[model samples]
Target: MIDSAVALPQGRRQRNKARVQERLFEAAVELIARHGYDNTSIDEIAARADVARGTFFNYYPRKDDLISEWSARRGTELRRSLVTEAGGLEPGDTVSRFHRCLAALVELNEDRQEVNRSMVTAAVRAGCLGARESATAELFTAILTDGQARGEIGEGLDPDRLGLLLRDAYLGVLTRWAVGAEQDHASLYRELHEVFKVFLIGALPRTAHRDCCPHTA
Candidate 1:
């Protein structure tokens, strides 16, 4: 098994394994939704999934592994949204795409502060935040790389470096909101958009910058 999982399920055995994992993940999510992540026990999750407590470990070696899956599904959904929300497969300008990404992030957790707080807190406790942050950076890198290919971002800019910078700034906003820096969803949305604007000031191509800030030209 690769990283405690089959790389891909080609046979009935692997397919069955995948289905069991899906059940475990959904069960954990339901419990975490009702009870805080920390308060939810593996035994409870297993019972909710109709599996023995030991069976849960067969799929998820650790409880945090389930949490990681829970967290990653959201990220995968958000990335898919960047296209689906834009209508079909055509991508928009990188600037607008980036904006949409951050906007969706706020909307994703805005109404569920307690849930978001609980999950993020649990992720931190599980020491998985760094992995999550790395995933975000990887997404940003892909976005920047796409932009560069489309001639939207500067050719000289290092996509990896810029991506990490954007990730840091992007997560910084969420970090504050997650910790109650923003009192409500509306407040969090505003900060996310505002921070994205600030990031764009430097992130934009020189020519594009002039267009955005006409007076600067």
Candidate 2:
């Protein structure tokens, strides 16, 4: 059975709630950036946002929720960019498509360097700030699976392991860039692309010396 009774003020209250939530999220980001994750408190965020402490609780059960929300939003944006960029690439173009995706991700991070640095620092410290890590890994796995099915990526490469490797490498590079590294982003990406091309495509000469199980590249 469903209750169809309506409250006249329900709609208005919902709108108000949304507005308060937005304010709380904004306040939390600012406070976290200023005070670091361990020191930032819900009461501080509420006061900074000019909302009551109860309002803060209504939006985020805890301070970490704010970080999780932010990470999820950024992950969604990255996934969208990857999908849109890879839309029409041929199977043979998988390597190029992946390079473009990596470049796009670097550019996106460059645009949000400060927030990214802060988030990475917090996540590294707290270990699990981003709930979307698994989702991002899944996205990589799908991309690799498609490439492999089409004969673009090499056979016998475990999609899950490859995905995890790529995520670690990408995050490691971004982490370095975030910490005031002056390396040229494009050059670094090109080098990595070359490595990936040789490793995944087996384009290197048979006689070329190579260690087994090189995760990078």
Model 1 stretches with alpha carbons more than 4 Å out: 1-16, 83-89, 111-113, 202-217
Each candidate's TM vs. the true structure? 0.73, 0.72
Per-residue alpha-carbon lDDT of model 1 for 35-89, expressed as tens digits? 8887899999899899999998888897778667767776766767675554333
For all candidates in order, the CA lDDT equals 0.73, 0.67
The true-versus-predicted C-alpha distance at residue 35 of model 1, in Å, is: 2.9
Where model 2 places Cα greater than 4 Å from the true spot, the runs are 1-13, 84-92, 129-133, 181-206, 209-217
For candidate 2, write residues 1-217 as lDDT tens digits. Answer: 5322234345777768767878887887787666666678778988999988887777788666776788776776767766655453333366666766666666666664556667766765566523335555666777788888888776868888887776666665555665655666475566556545654556556666376558755
Could you tell me which 10 consecutive residues in candidate 2 have the lowest summed lDDT?
Answer: 1-10
Residue 22 error, candidate 1, Å: 2.8
**Model 1: ten consecutive residues of lowest lDDT:** 1-10
Q: Report the error of model 1 at residue 131, Å.
A: 4.0
